[model samples]
Target chain A: MSRRILNLILGCASVCVGLTPMRAQEFKLFERTVQVHGFASQGFIYTNDNNWLTMNTSQGSAAFTDFGLNMSTQITDKFRIGAQGYDRDLGQLGQYHPSLDWAVADYRFKSWFGIRGGKVKTTLGLFTDTQDLDFLHQFALLPQSVYPTDLRDATLAHVGGDIYGNILLQHHLGDLAYTVYAGHRSDSKYSGYSYFLTKYGVTSSSFAGLQYGSDLRWSTPLKGLLIGASRMNEEITDNGNLSLGPGIDFTSYSAVSRADWTNQFYGEYVIRKLQVDSEYRRYLHDQIVSPDSLETISDVRGWYISGCYRITKRLALGSYYSRYSITSVAGGAAAPFFPDQTDTSLPANHVYDKVISGRVDLNKFWSAKVEGHFMNGYGNSSFPDGFYPLANPGGFKPNTNALVLKTSVNF
Target chain B: MKNLRLLPLVAFLVLLAPVRARAAQVKIIANPSVSTDAISGRELKSVFLEEKNSLSDGSHVEPVLLKSGPVHESFLRQYLSRTDDDLRNYYRVLVFTGRGSMPKELGSDAEVVAYVAGRKGAIGYVSAEAGVDGVKTLAITDGRSPVERRVITRIEPEYPETLKRLNIGGIVRLQVTIAPKGNVENVQLLGGNPILGESAVAAVKQWVYATAPSRTRIEVSVPFNPQP
Candidate 1:
């Protein structure tokens, strides 16, 4: 026989011999269990205005298509590992990157507690952790007003070591389940866009921060109905150095309450607020704009109401209306950060936006969604400016309306 | 006058013969290895429903049931105070939730009797008239002195007949009192559908058994047959 055929035959014979019973009455030994699963999704997004779509920021709304692959495996009862990669084009910019999403060993003491040490993803809000794989959730895209960060980026989520647990309390008054986590998040400087900008001779900074968050959820059975309330808090440290002070440090708080009648009808309302303390620094061909500090404090408030109906066991339909507004206060004796900048007509920025979305679940692993956004106020645009090569665009014009359609799948 | 008197005497003897035979026909036996007296109906019901998985001696007990048909229906009604339909549905829910497994069903009373007798941990019920040897006949109710048959009506005058009809397939909860001589004295419907409640009470009252005294709660459903 050929060498390949000989090798194949030998392999099969070895496997058979390895599985043979060793003793006449002994129970079988040599156990093997293996499972393989993953998912891929790709979809196109178009914009009504090409210029709005082409705006460049860490994440911008541009018409493009993206796809990603994620695979995980349980090496044993206590250990799991996973990896994911995504390639996408947003308006004018394109990217292709792969990263380790989950590489952790979870030791579960009981049903309510576990300590996971390794690179772990933190789930804060309802859809915070699963923001990627848009196909798996109800919205075509994440709620931009709430999850303003890019879902495809690793820096937006958590990585590092975490200890998480849940406490369940049953009392005469009600039932409560609280989940809390404390962890230090670390990422390679290359995980953020600043690293790339810096490589291109543009002034940028490195970031590494600590995150601690907790969520308290309570549900009470009232006359055969379930009513629930939830509160969450997240705090992050300044991980970079800006000309003003350190880098932007922020604290976010969210509160939500919901009522569910049976498993069919449910309604929830959530409010989120973020406090940002940072400064704007100027650069002249990679030189500091000023030697003194120019501090800026920005605050954003957003909220939404959503309702969902499960039409069938594997199908559901939902709708949500949400709004977000941001205000920034600039302080310290400062000159126009960029003298070469052209759009000098603007003052301190503010933005207001409203979005209405509807979604349909096609299956447990897939969903389709469509949404329309009505933005009225102009705020600091997260776009790069053309006038000053180093000064990023800081404002966007208001009264822009756009519609989006998205689909996602997960395995 | 002489012929009429003779006819009356003969009628009395004929009626007494069947009653005597029925009383004599009742037999109780445990498996050869089992040392205890036949279980009471209440204990049997508890064992079959898994409310208790062990007997007084701490021996594990497993109940076998007929898969379907008249015997299954009769067994459930006589012991569980539930219709076969309701029992089957409840078991399905339990099995789905991993609470317990459905009892193994045999083909017929003969099979059920043989299986229960041969298996050390097995228990099952068959017709009082099956005349099967080896297996035991648990008393339907415990007491002595021919207990008066008392029909405990559960339905009010205003209950709908349709609901009453459905109650035939619904669960009937009853609290029963058995005398020390194995005679049933009183039964009260603790809960259940109002429609079939009367028939259930009536059927239970007519049940006769010979066993030790015991007071226990039981649920049984008596099915209605339009053809009968």
Candidate 2:
């Protein structure tokens, strides 16, 4: 990756020329306060041909990275609590381990009621609970047709409980924010769908699921608009094995999925230093597979539209136009046990792309970005949306053009 | 075409030079135990957007900030419409969503009139040539014009049969607060499609307005038309 992007641009120019001036950190403990936050990022992908997500980015992958850390406290004035942990690798997906990513405990009790419980974080649309708060975004990637990032742990947090609130619409007509959750996700056999199911020789081991959801939003009185919607439901299962060829035998396979669901719909609009966003999602699933149950049903669909401006105060600019698709509808009893659920008549069943980004900042908690993609389709490879077929074992290509370089930091 | 008639005098001298360099003389001090000397620009944008901590003569308030000058950019663009990186990303999304904290900025207007004159339910702003002697300068009143509460009655909302059978319509904002003796004492939902914002907050909680002089937060919209 160009010598890992020149050693991450000389380690972000010697930490932006030996930086100084930072914030976000607090402490007090029993006297309340607590705080503390953290973030880190790095990326450098290049492509001219194929090899994307499973990263080799056509021989130029800087094995993206990630980092996080959090802490919080309120301890009264309506109780509070928090936690975070996170880590990433991205090339073959989160192989660096370190999970946790949320801990919750919240309480609230007014501003229209509240409640929360462990693991939380899963609002679903509009950057799904601030997708790892990447310095609150300007995009380095977010709209791989709706925040994909290799299905960031299949919907990031959820180990149970939430109730949320924020109502206040009387005569001014503006304010409403709900939540309602349920949980128990689990994934991560080294994610990215267990490394794209080892290109069909399967081998997952377990996956787990049974989510639930709701989200609502609406902070509209026209000033800096916002709108939201989400709805989810899952059941999942996975298990693993299947191989039996040129190997010491294997074969157990499983799939399950008791009628999945998803819906999403978003919008945002800001009017100073410009900003705009849009989203749409769908998802339907319905699995059954196994030694012979069959049944399938897929549907997926994604959408996007983006914009960013902040022209100055350390530059900013963005663009987007993503799209994704997946069909299948039980391809004749699951097309002989899934071939990435093909049939959308080629172009590997859809993906569109068309990015363009730029960000700078370099202080106030650093930032740096440069994106450009053009992509066109390579979708259906077991939907992580970023094409994979075992990271392209040299077999499909319709269009590709990429170049990314990221850098981040948070305080 | 004669430079399109000097394009309307060069767009009115480029929007009158940023509205005369962002006019905003500032001054709205408070803290003499804040029992009012007059306030209201929507309660100083709900006490600097901590969304109300009191005032309307019930006193209690705190708000203080300045950390950036030009009267903290004209009191965050004339009463918190915000900007200063949108009020520091709205207080970093209220301190990363734990909802609120980080207010009390300070750094001149004589350190915000010496921390809103020794804090006591604070409140601040200065620069109409600073020197506010021991606080309490208030007096504003730009109620952001909504032509004094009209609509004395209006209801309308009821479209949700599975979102009008899935064709889903739009326009559902609501933010009513009225009650100075004109009903609608609350009704949030300020955008659309939360099942048409719970049917526009149940028909704007039984509409009725015009009786002002105090409570009044108006903003309504509710149009759901799945064609014919």
Candidate 3:
């Protein structure tokens, strides 16, 4: 057909060929000064009653996939340039659309001061930095109540500059890491903001927004103990004729903690491992509505506690309980479609999920995981009717069971 | 009669162990750019883990690695306390998170040595017998500052639950050098089960030692034998 179509076909064929054995070897360039790496993953989802990430996954659907390629060059002792291109298909979320995940030019001026400018991965939770790398953890999916995948686009990266540094303290106090960034949030269609609007049937959506925040983490001298707090504020210009009127202000604050403990048995590479991770977030958004001329703030809060123990180096077992609540309805514009209603058939904004998972790391670059989740709420999703199959005979069931299995390979 | 029959086999294994251990011989080497002549166990871990990127003298340091070999395995077990696979995952986290990049991983000791010798601030480990005419061999010193090596605040290692449940017991030996300022400066894993040794090292490194006029080194033995 056309040249574009031909190129697309060839690219697809090349990726397909590379993925059959789906492994990336270390590719070096310029006398090994530059390094390139990549990964691809596919996931299968099954639910008994409701859909977790996509529709019609109850009977099993392979609608989830993530492919990424990244490269970095250490130009000097204190400078480096890196970038990654990623395509994710989670039902209609990414639809295999390619996007720049992150690109940064870094400068480490001193031990206590450094700067990174460009698209930077930005997340405040304990494991949010590794949120996209499924092969690193014991679960196929992170606890969504706190680190929702749907909201990743708008919150996962910042297109501005960030200043970061560390200060080492004495004794048990440990070291402190602080990162502060300022820039406009990503307004891509896959953004959580876009997800919120589209899922709520809000037309004429414009997510152009300005955001800034800082995160401080304290790595205690107590080995694997770490605690941190993060906060970000965003101002969105709706430019919409429907739903959120015009101006929306969102502020998010989170407290995070994590610890890794290895068993003394087996020693070395085969140690039995026990790890605990946690995060709690409070969200406040200023929404405005006309006609009634009502202005109010909605408060949403969520938290999760997770523990994983490695039975062996390659195998790990884990479980977690997560809950999210619309703590306050108050006066804010809870929007029109998914309005603030304490008594409704759809409850609309509360979610609870309990998950148990197991992961088998086949090797350094390959892994497989199986996770089962008992979910009672859909607060994590921005949809009003929810992501479950509408064919439900019971007409809107809040509780459901979902099973997820995934195989991931990263170089 | 059965035990007597296997005596030669046991002796054979005992005598052959040294050969295998020798095959895994390792030494720490650094580029000529690195000015430090010594590194403690703690400092080495921090550098390789991407936690600390510079030496005590503010000299920038980059960690190189041999992809796979007996020397590579032994080096990781001795210093990083990780398996080769674990080390790979660790680098993945760093690169994926945009925190750091994967170090220059060479295929063999010669490759690593050549790379290290040619680059500034490069550090790598290789077989002890590997020819290293260009690179410098840095002595791993336990006594960094003699006056700061005295332990004033001691922390105990928490026995791992899996080990406690299985009733696994051992003593993890560590060589620690106290900083002149009295902070736990460097700790090197000398002997112990790898897993238990990791926990013991983590705990001992957090200890606050008494400061003297100069730094000092001390040997520590942490035992993990949970009581009923």
> For each candidate, what's the DockQ?
0.04, 0.03, 0.31
**Superposition TM-score, candidate 1 onto the true structure:** 0.47
Per-residue lDDT of A1-411 in model 2, one digit per residue for the tens?
A: 454564466456535632766677788877776878666777778999988887888878877777776788766545668776887777878756788777788776554667888887788887776675666788888887667788777786788988877665665667778888998988888887777877877888888888988989898888889898998898989989988578568979998887888898898998988888998998887887777567677787889889999888998999989888787644345466555465654577788888989899876777778999897878764455777887787777888999988877766
Candidate 3 docks at the CAPRI level of: acceptable
Off by over 4 Å in 3: A1-32, A199-201, A243-272, A290-296, A328-347, A380-395, B1-25, B142-213, B218-228
Decreasing TM-score order of the candidates: 3, 1, 2
TM-score of chain B of 3: 0.58
User: Candidate 1 lDDT (Cα, whole model)?
Assistant: 0.42
| Tens digits of per-residue lDDT for model 1, A43-144 | 334333222333332233333344444434334433434444544444333333345544455554432445565555554444445555454445565545
List chain A TM-scores, every candidate, in order.
0.60, 0.33, 0.80
lDDT of 3 at A383: 28
Candidate 3 per-residue C-alpha lDDT over B105-219 given as tens digits, one digit per residue, 9 for 90 to 100: 7898889889999988989998765778799876565433412234578888877775575455555657877766788788887655566778888998889866667766765
lDDT rank order: 2, 3, 1
Tell me, what's the RMSD of every candidate?
Answer: 17.3, 24.5, 11.3
